[model samples]
Target: MTPEELTRPWPPPTPKPAERGAPPTPVPSAVPRRRLLRWAAVGAILVLLVWSVQGTGVSVGALIDGREGGLHLVRGFLHPDLSAAFLADVGSAVLQTVQISLTGLLLAAPLGLAGALLIAGNVGAPGWLRGSARAGAAFLRGVPDLLWALLFVATIGPGPAAGALAIAVHGAGLLAKLGAEQLEAIDPAPVEAVRLTGTGRAATAVLAIIPQARAGLASLLLYQWECNLRTSTVIGFVGAGGIGQELAISLRLFRYDELSTLILAVLAMILLVDQLSRVIRRRMGAAT
Candidate 1:
């Protein structure tokens, strides 16, 4: 290279295709396409939201008009019925709700564990078995607890038994699905190490997989129990028997004060269950 050319610039710019007498490269449209796609997605989401609002009949004016009635209800809730007779009934209903939730969870735990074992990938279950288990769990979960309660109510007559059975079935499905995911997500090293010992499948799973997944499984079960408790109260509204039945009665009679008391009782029960679950989970974690 000439010294003059080297002194002109340390690095010279390449000539453009147009200057080289070649057809100018077409500017890529990718950026514009991407921008269009993003705008399209935003528009689609906005359309969906508007459609949902219209279909659901959401109205700011209706909410404003109901302010007085809402205040009346709030006042009733503030001054909840605390009469001795009513309190006694509330206590009984609360006990029944607790019993129903306990019964449901007890019945669900074993069934859920079995289903979890079948569906869990690390367990080496056959594909067909896993698929079948998944299908069964889906069926159980697809039917709402309220519908299950109605079915049981029709078959066994309305009572806490129906509610318990409903909760059991639904809780089993929930636990099975969650437990399977938990099992799948556990540390694979322990499982692999156990298998290397030439242990049988069941032995390896019990020793390695179960131990690793125990805390998660326990947490899932406890959470399901809390869910069952809520479901128990709801099922009672269908005459399946629990605090929900009392709630239904109060609503039918327009006894807002009693309804408020029942609501408070439900809230207290939920808070108690939540706290108990947290403590149990903490202890389990510590023990592990």
Candidate 2:
């Protein structure tokens, strides 16, 4: 109202409480070169992924179109044929499968252990012997299981015996390879101690080294058994005589219900072996 007040210049507006004592806005630093490259790579990957999905025609619509067949399978699973006849057939098949796997496992143990010891140079075997064993194990492992089964079938005819031999030969090589690795990783102190006492190589292994690696060897053996169990069914498809033979026959006849039953039986056997292996491994751990 006064002339002096009107002549005074207007003052700058006061900052709000929230803005008081705040630092000035800062400029963003340049991103690192590596970070930019990473982001670029990630974007490229995403583009490729999207293009692949589209190229493959993988979409919700395709899944929906396939649901009818899936539903039919689910329905058969829900009402699996559990009749006496079915059970009897499944039981016989299961027995044959188990027999083949068991026989193979039994055969693999001695062969695999011998092969492992032969390959692990600590046993004082001749260099030639070790090399020979290594080559033999590699050869067996290199050949596919189906080919082994076919080879045996040609000589022994299409039966459980052929299946057993096939799985045995294949499983032995795997077990030996894994077992030798375990042996190599064992502490050398015990082996050295036995050697200092004038023990023979075989005696030292039996007394000291073998005990240390026993649990691992057992795990390898049980793992091979599990593999052989699964392989037994596959070999049966080639007329080796097991549930897979029945499965092939059922599939050929389009007997969905019977197929479901066979699948359930196989699943049961797998679970049983799984539980058994777990129990055995636990016992081995406790013993060690």
Top of the candidates by TM-score: 1
| CA lDDT of each prediction against the hidden true structure | 0.92, 0.88
lDDT of each residue in 1-288, candidate 2, tens digit only: 999989877795688766797777778766787799999999999999999999999899988999998898778778878899888999999999999999999998899899999898676678999899999999988998889998999998999999999999988888778888888788998889899999988898798878888889889888888888899989888878788888888878867889999998999999999999999999988988
Structure candidate 1, residue pairs in collision: none
Ten-residue region with minimum lDDT total, candidate 1: 4-13
Question: What are the RMSDs of all candidates, in order?
Answer: 4.0, 10.8
Tens digit per residue, CA lDDT, model 1, 1-288 = 888887897578889878899897688779889999999999999999999999998899989999998888888888999999999999999999999999999999999999999999899988998899999998998899999999999999999999999999988898889999999999999999989989887897799999899889988989998998889989999998999999999989878899999999999999999999999999998999
Clashes of 2: 0
* Candidate 1: stretches off by over 4 Å: 1-16
Candidate 1: give its CA RMSD in angstroms: 4.0
TM-score of 1: 0.91
Give candidate 2's error at residue 130 in angstroms. Answer: 2.5
Q: Give the count of colliding residue pairs in each prediction.
A: 0, 0
Q: List candidate 2 segments past 4 Å from native.
A: 1-68
